[model samples]
Target: MKSKGFGKKALDLLFPPRCQGCGKLIDRDDGLCGACLAKYGDEQRESCPVCGRTARECSCGAAALGSSFIGNRRYCAMTFYNEYNADSERITEKLIFRLKRKNSSSLTDFFAREAAAEIMRLMQLSEERPEEWIITWPPRTPRAVLEYGYDQSEAVARRISYYTGIPWKKMLVRTGGREQKGLGAEEREANVSTLALLRRKEADRKRFILFDDVITTGATVREAADLLYGAGAEAVFPVCIAKTLLKEKTDDEGVFV
Candidate 1:
């Protein structure tokens, strides 16, 4: 006789759920597929909230770069993409690998959900009063967006907005700046922050969290934040999916508050 267990029934109903990470069929309902999930299990690790590195390194790492415009501000993220440099600067670096090449729809959702959960945690821990939190990512020039087909940062942010219920808008634009990822470590540090502005409307709200897929040099996001601050935004906090955990010297401190 067959077992009448509900677990067996649920499994049959889903009939081999697909994995979010590698796109393989799995026997569970977890966030990721088995193989792909395990592959990145080690890839994704805890990051420092203060500096978006490791918890232990947060003290020194964040303090060293705490001189930039958004330096002293508080933002929460699930992981840090900037840390990918120590390992590799390849095109498929960090979140780019899963979201782009793998074509994993669930993968981006996984990131958004994780980030939303972290944000919730931070709000509870710090007792941040929720007036209104807008979620926006670094914008791309029309030419760049046409070239890439889609901006992975904004795509991930869109999914995040759906999951977290936080309003996201096109409040920041990108001026013609050097690609932060392609630059060498030193060049990445030397590039100045230049955030383009978005015209405001009647329904527009302030107090926002800038979202990005990854934060390597932090220059790109910093530039975006500068633009928002200049446009009468009450506050701008950045949230990247992943951050660089590697050791490096920073002249600009990544932020200035």
Candidate 2:
């Protein structure tokens, strides 16, 4: 009541900003504009040279299915982390925040559309028979899900179904283990720390592709593969929308799952 009107006016003026993805004006949302949806209409569709995964550049050397002694198959990524735009990266970062803080399941639609677009493209590129394949993502522990309200990764997997014409199996359960952070590549690469397990009645011979928005240490997928194989998935491989390059980076992050 003392001087509320002037301060409120000044605060509004100072906070006025445009959406990062598109130049549109908005009352609240940032990072992405309303029309900044990802379109793969002109993206490259060639298979990768080094690993047979799909990509224009063949920089991959990750272990293949038979080589892993576990991983079922390998596939291509629609984009490298390098291709991520500033606005998109911000949105991605926001998703991590929303998951970590708000823990809202509603954000799935916002994050999954971007991921789904990329996965749909991957399925489109495969020469394998076109039938519905099982879908999955790393599951969060019951404690984490309850603490955060929902599993963002699972929410992401659910969103992917509509675009990929696949079904997600709710066959995995988390053990509510410790989080992986500040872990090195070597340790991460050899991680035996898995926090999830498959349901008893779920089919073991089911074909499925695991999903993750990010794949930094490779440990997350590596650990998940063990549980999945044990569950009886005939084969299971990962399908990330973006990949990290081997080149020294400037830390300018980009679009994410």
lDDT, each prediction: 0.58, 0.54
Residue-by-residue lDDT tens digits, candidate 2, 76-97: 3444444334434434433344
Estimate the TM-score of every prediction: 0.66, 0.58
- Model 2 — which ten-residue stretch has the worst lDDT? 64-73
Q: Point out the worst 10-residue segment of candidate 1 by lDDT.
A: 63-72
Q: Residue-wise lDDT of candidate 1 within 1-257, one digit each (tens)?
A: 26666565575585666665444676765556655555555545555444464531243234332222233335443444543432353322544555643434556677777777766656556666544677887775544565556767777788878877777787766555465666888886766444567665411346777887766666776667666666667777767665565454443333322
Model 1: CA > 4 A from native? 1-17, 27-31, 35-73, 80-95, 100-104, 175-195, 200-205, 248-257
The TM-score measured for candidate 2 stands at: 0.58
> What C-alpha lDDT, on a 0 to 100 scale, does residue 123 get in candidate 2?
54
